[model samples]
Target: MTLGNFSRVTEFILLGLSDTRELQILFFAFFFLAYAMVLLGNLLIIVTVKADPKLSSPMHFLLCNLSFIDICCTSVTSPRMLVDLLSQRKTIAFEDCIAQLFFLHFVGATEMFLLTVMAYDRYTAICKPLRYTVIMSRQVCWVLVFACWAGGFLHSIVQTLLTIQLPFCGPNAIDNYFCDVPPVIRLACMDVHVTEWLMVSNSGLISLVCFLVLVTSYTFILVTVRVRFTEGHWKALSTCASHLMVVTLFFIPCIFIYLRPFSSFSSDKHICVIYTVFCPVMNPLIYTLRNNEVKASMWKLWQRYVEGRKRTVTFPGDTDHCILPAINSLLQYTSVIISTMKDKMHKVNTSTVSEFILIGLSDAPEVRFFLFVLFLIIYLVTMASNITVFVAISTDTRLHNPMYFFLGNLSLLDILCPTITVPKMLEVLLSENNVISFSGCILQLFFLVDVVGTEILLLTVMAYDRYVAICQPLQYVNIVSMKLCARLAIGTWVVGFFNSLLHTSLIFTLFFCASNEVEKYYCDIAPVLALSCLPTYSRELVILTVAGVLGSSAFVVTLVSYVYILLAILCMNSAESRHKAFSTCSSHLTVVCLFYGTTICTYVRPSSAYSPDQDRIVSMLYGILTPLLNPIIYSLRNKEVKCALGRVISQVRTTLTK
Candidate 1:
């Protein structure tokens, strides 16, 4: 069977769900927006996972993989289909058809089985608590993830092989769009009964097993939750509940569509939409919304956005206030808690952040003195608090581990990240003529670049730190020694500083110093890059090259590290040890979720969709809120930190008692 003997057809027509003109327009607009959302959403997952240290787990590793999958899987057909819907052409070539079918099924099935494997991971951690480490050893996790990919590969290869062998010499028009096996096989001139059965056996059978395993995994997981009910089992149940909801939503429709032969199904088109388009659309929402942890992180992120608006009172100049329905609709589908989503909103002037207008009761000149006095107290507290933290970490002999080292670096970054933007922003707000010079803008650009880039690099390094500590606990001391910690921390700053140099330098090269208005609340690259009056090719290449290179590498490293961590966690024996291992890593997982969710959301597009308004919103998380949350989460949620704090408090109380 010579492959090119396969006729090199130009293109084949896609018989999409609707041929009606109005419906076509409607679908085109709808899917176009959805495609954007899909890109934005998946990108968000990657960034958040990469940036926030909390999400450093095997599950998040798989999640980041799935996000990449969703983007890749949906990209295969959606954009083209949307484009075709708007154009006269609606055809796919035979080879392209085969490619589409393979990618769709391979990524789709890989995601399905990956979900099952994740559930089993949850079950083993919960139910077989004692032997979890040994059971889910690093080797086992690789085997599991490999099995998933291998299984998807084999399944897709078999299906594609079976389909290609059939005679499709007639009726190139495919119904309900795309190169699906059922519809593609239906076009076969020869009898596809045998191939159909094979499809049923492989596709249907795999779905069945995955469904069963998910069910069984949840069942045992339920029992484990019951045993731990007295311990406020809400967290465990919430995790299980979220996974079940997403899995059921993902597999139920899939099972229904492919379970039987391609017979009379009145809703095939709708089912296909649910499985293909909606599944990817809903996944991020399901994961983010249902889990309280994700919801909390997102809420924290949203708060930053709200604060950004308050500080930048001029608001974004180019914001499309229209179609707020998209986010509203998203809220309907997601579990992000709305009430806690925003408060204490503050605005900053992005255009001239050289010196901020001081907050005073200047509306009434008599009260100006009182206002200044009130704010002076807060300013002092803010500086003192930050200085105290910096000093404590720098001086404390005991606070010298990789963990504390990272924490100190973060505090130092946070102390500086806000200082560069905030005070200047305040000064501009106070005086009528408060404005910044070119040198000031350039300085601001440098620090802003360093702050964001360093944070991203630091978050990735922290994930690696967590991976070493949790996965290689026995060797953690040797592996992540003080010298190593110093080196990693220094490496994070070095990479970030250099990356920022490329980004800031490229933007400055093209952006004329004459265009004084910076159309953003903070000195972010996307909006600044947008400000360039010159050709954007070089600027884009540099900005994206640096951000993309750093972002991609961070994501890959985080994902790979989690895979090993999952393997290590799974290998533990004895429930107590397993619980402790996972527990120790939980904070890191949470932070990773926050970091990846925000950063990926901000950067992972083609650089064309970087809206100043949306960029500011996403940047808030990727830069500000996430870094802030890092210390809060690690300090509040981590027992070690809590113990350390308690020890400090106890000493103070003892002195008071004396």
Candidate 2:
């Protein structure tokens, strides 16, 4: 069918679980907490399984994959559902609905097949102990995982193709939180009886076959255990119990929903929540609480972290007692600043504007397309490299020192900085829809300021770390205790939050009646302030004052630390020692120069000096290019990071080939 004949509806309204305001609020809180738990629990499992040498078995490997799938599956629907529960309109665009349907089934079916494979794994380990290793070797495990993913892809493509080609000329209300095969197929313009049955057979038969196989595998394993009646048998049975519980929770909901025609039964939406929301939340809890090995590994990891925190060094005449008072005074001053800003905002005149137009990078179509592709590649590489560094530092205990800890924070900031701006820029480039609501503009500026401010403080702290490591080598461990590191990290974030809040509150309080066109692709302080009708002298003065104090202080500290570091390096008798010392700081110094150079050029100048074209290029250097280069700089220059990354890569390779 042509585009005109495909569908008349541009979007679909979702009637979520309830219409009552009280019920919606309650459900929102419930699901928000549940989603947070699902993410944290599954991530902990993945990290623990990777970090601990004790969890190198094939069973644990499969469990790690299962945890990853749980995260992917829940993320597909939970975020959208949570947003809808809070939203009044609760609508999804036509293309978004179809994409959701595709990934929902793709990851869902993949999990089902993986669970069945885990069942088979258990059966071999228990019933065929003599040949278990031979049968379920590393190569065989890789093949099984590959097969599961391939099967899931095939299954999802068939469903998506069938549903996408159907004509939905009108009536685009879906009576559930998300898009799915049955509910979506029911909305077709033509009769869907044949399509419904075909989809049902496709989904239902797979669930049934997997369910039956799991059942038979468990049954045989149980019988074998009863006959053998050994200590090893008892342990295997305990492991099987966790898997069985997960299997029961997951498959029962799949069978109940798919093994029928498309109908709007009252229980349909509720049952969908079981496999979609409940299963992912419960999987980690079931495995960790029931399986001894996982529990032990988690406990060890926690103990190590706690022990590191507790090993604080004490020195004679130390002023540690004064630290708490200083922090308390700082917090009190911040509260006063916030209150003063609120009062000032209330006194200012409010504007009538609701949205602003963003004049993107270029007007030509080809230029826009080129920018889109360029930024898209940058965004992907930034995310991949930063996530690799973050995960490497997290999962490898060797990289647990203060330097890597700060580097991990830097990686996280790199991830957040680009994520705050790039996706919207990509959308604007692709669709030429450059209008942003007032609230979105405020949020974008707020988070951008927060990440940048946090990075400033974090870099200063990292420089201090290097100074201590180089200048006070004997006292490095005692001075940079994990507790102090944690406190410093928290302090940076807290200060950054207040700093961003103060600037955002101050800027938005001014009336914005002059113009609605933002000169840059994304919202920033200079552009937004330039659009204000009222005199921005007070805001500008405040920005200058704060930037001077904070920026100068951080720069002085970093500069002084590096100066001392250079002196210490030059004084070293061994050339080899000097080279090693400087190598450790090179990556951070390069990043510092890139970040501060672009930031100072853009923000330190008066608003009257702002050139739109020049400002955009400068902003991209700090906002986009810096994040893309940070991890590459660290990975290439830092030997320990390289080794940790190598170990992570080799572990994955070994898993696939051993």
Candidate 3:
């Protein structure tokens, strides 16, 4: 029973997946192809995701990581298994067996953790659409990946330690094909009840817990998708279903293999092969075939290659002199094609307006006074709150960081935002003069667009800041330098300015021979575009394209940043550190939800669905309420801000009393 009393076995004989030579040959060929497919398929996924900009969401980002893990997992098990199938001996040295065991468990555990993280990602995307970007930023994603590897490494070390500690003296025949805790633990000379129990608890219990949590999370997601299906809901559901399929494939085999007693191993080798080789091969198929986006991306890539070949295929014969001549012909042909396209396009109107009327929030005489008083109070409070935060962040040395710097910029925008329209709104409500000049409307729209665009970029920057601070803390100062911060800040404003210019120019270019009265309280893009008598198809296309780029770009940036942030936070050893990190982002996250949610509702729809009452309410959220709530959200959730506010108040009181 003791180690000194037994002769340690120096080698082990693997029975392989089959015993007979014919069956082994069959197994070898099948596994060889499967292993090739696993490598090729995962490589394609990694390459496709990396190469395509359209596939730059957090979901795809994690998919890339998953594919990489699958490659590592398959490489650890399949190659050796294939070689053993052909060899007569099928023997593995003691050290080689331990090495295989270590790697298999390591990659497998890493993959398990990766899959669970991916489930959380799907949950975020489906359940919390608005906050998805801020929640799953790039910084968060990287951190999650690191944590996955770290967890896997720790787990593998424990398992390998347990298995290797057992003295293998007599029976050197392992029933299964590969080195795993289950089959190998049975060959120990001593009583391995304690080891088996530990292995079961480690791998078995962990797999079960992860599987249960994955199912539970997907259950909520399915419920949500079923109840409130939208434009892209089916795509989301398909993705979740594919993930669920994969989860089922991975966990069922794992539980069956690991959870049972060592003596219970009957035909589990068949199940083992399913996970070790077959499951990995199926992942790319499930993800790519079921996913329309990935399929389209693959198709697009194929099409581009075909088109590139077509463009490069030189006119049937090519001598050295003809190569230059062919190039010249190609350029000439391209120019002619471009000219022909331009000739077919119709002319667009480019008219300008002198003055216009604004049909503000309300026209009822009874509520005019009340409405004026209410919004006046709101405007005053918004300005006061934002200004307070702006001042606090400016003066407080403790708040001098990239996050607070961005916060200060947001506060300033919050103040300027309401100021652009609230004054005119209050005037219109009180005087019942719902008339805004054309120049004035354009000016108001310009600032609105500018501020909105700037805010989007700012949110993205804040996410990046959080990513660097949490994920790459050592390089945070060097990367997010004051000079870099200034450049980013200035760049956002400049981009917003140009964006507003393009939109305003496009808006005014349309002939507005219709009524001057605007529908909503302020001159928003959609409402103003509706009044243009001329066909605004081109203008609409331009607007949609620009807005799409801006919105989608900001979204991807934020999502990628938070993905890394989430990963980093999850990896933190201490609960208090995680809580602290989350708290730092909570305020910004809330503001992101409020801003993006309302903006998308207002602008990202057709004019046909535009409702005045609904628009006003939604407008009030981002315009008035968001600004009003932002400072409150920051001051309340952030302890530093609260303390700073208290100090400011104390200073003011002391000054007054003196």
Candidate 4:
């Protein structure tokens, strides 16, 4: 029962799909394309689903969730596998495998549950059309989503609990691509036959249940469709067909692998390719190509984009809607798309961040000096941007208001966000071998959690700000005053800090640091927490509680705020003023909708249906795009800001002419 009784294995040898060099190269090429597909497809789905009103139903909601799941599920295996294939070494540490096992199952099980719910939803809609609205109302739908997630957590807890308890003091090589129950259980030195049988019911049975539910539901629905078949009814089938096809592909592969006895499948590597890599790649493509609504929406968006581009490229001599400003934003959009998951919401420094090496000579004079200079610049910029924004709002009389106050807090968070990441980054870069002390990595984990938590909290507050401004315009001053803003801002940071602290602390609690090299450049709490050598129910419990509280609370508050805002907007009488109000709110609404909607698509649901890369891009909307757009949006359309800019430009032009 105790980890103390078992000998501690430091690292693990990962037997990637094949040991052959030719196979490795071929696989790398194949997986690289798959990873790209996962990224592009998911982003396209998120953007298209968001842009279209017709695709804004609970059905598209499930699809968006699927896109996100496919993204993470692919990232879990493919990118790492691709890197491993290229390198001479193909090994994953014992600790890393455990982490992978947890997430792999967590996301996988979550998706299974989500698919079952989607099937049920379709069955209810098609089979019981009269009662569909009452049964699948917005509240009921969200509840079902909540229940799906709850089921995922409960299932994942059982599997992780079983796996982590096994004493793995034997052969370190994992036979297949990544960690799974069969491969991992095979590595255990202790008798796992009982656990294996339990898994038959656990992994195999759970999947079978979901599959049967899907099969039965689809059969009845298809029969229902046949009964009501008409010439015009063909189009209706397309929407559900895409989902059904993708679901079949996803579930069949899953059932083939999981539902069967572990020995029944010769290699999980080939199976891994199907579920983790191919399913995700296929999902976005299948959904987008098959769904007419998404295609129409994407077409409109493309037309707008191309026409906008044409206005710039074709008309060099003419100033169309201030072409210079559009030109200026060109680089900004490009940079945002390329940035990392953490840097998703903010404008990141464009300089290449080299991998940190921790060779002994890193302590030498030249190395230390270079590191100080390198990290100092990064640290200085990170601190300055956040501090300046914070001070601009906090101290300046002009900015002594709720809007600026929230912005100041965000800046402060941005400051902390990079602080958590870049310190160890510089430390590793300075060190010749890129080693981080256990204490230091844990420290970085703390910073990562706290800063991210702060940002999420701040965004929720910002949503409230918009609600007040648009909905309760007259009493905006009274409601979101200086004091209230300060309290909310403070509370937000405090909640995030404490939450992050719990997870970071858990990493050090059961953990004896085995691997210093993190797959990610910066330390993240989830990945770090994943490295635990002990039973993971405790860690997952903390994750469930924290993620549930933060993710749900933020989403609910923001969603409720918009509902009120919509109600108030509808009640207003002034047509011109209404148009003006809608215009002003449109940009903010668009940004907010993109932020929380994408987040909920992944996090608010259980881990099942969210994609890692989709999570990356969607999160990036807040992380990279929002920060860049915040300054742009606040400055561009505001008459005061535009006037200020015009004044500065006119003064420069006048002086030049003179």
Using lDDT as the measure, the top candidate is 2
Model 4: per-residue Cα lDDT at residue 69: 79
Candidate 1: segments with Cα more than 4 A from true spot: 1-9, 12-178, 182-382, 433-443, 466-473, 509-516, 533-658
lDDT on C-alpha atoms for all candidate structures: 0.68, 0.87, 0.81, 0.66
How does each model score on TM-score? Answer: 0.48, 0.52, 0.51, 0.48
Global lDDT of model 3: 0.81
Off by over 4 Å in 4: 1-5, 231-233, 263-265, 310-314, 317-658
Q: Judge candidate 2 at residue 138 and give its lDDT.
A: 82
Models ranked on lDDT: 2, 3, 1, 4
- Stronger candidate by TM-score (2 vs 4): 2
What tens digits encode model 1's per-residue C-alpha lDDT throughout 1-658?
2462353334568878687654565466556656776888888888777766776666676677778878877887797688677666788777788899899899889989988998987887677767777887757777888888889999999888887877656678777677787777776776667778888899878988888898898888787687776444556566666677768778888888778886443437667777677878778867875554554566566667778987986533333342245345545633232222211111212233333212221345446445445444544554544454555566666776787788778777877776776565445435433355645665687787777678777777877887888766788898688765765776677667666655655555453433545555555555555555565654564455456556766775677577667777788887887787777567777877886777766754434556666665666565555555655666676666656655666776899999
The Cα RMSD of model 3 versus the native structure comes to 23.6
Residue 399 miss distance in model 4 (angstroms): 64
RMSD of each: 16.8, 22.9, 23.6, 18.8
Candidate 2 residue 528 C-alpha distance from true site, Å: 35
Local accuracy of candidate 4 as per-residue lDDT tens digits, 9-93: 6667778888765455445545665587688879888878877788767788777777787787878877778778767787786
> How does model 4 score by TM-score?
0.48
Query: What lDDT is reached at residue 215 by model 4?
Result: 86
Q: What is the lDDT of candidate 1?
A: 0.68
Worst-scoring 10-residue span by lDDT in model 4: 349-358
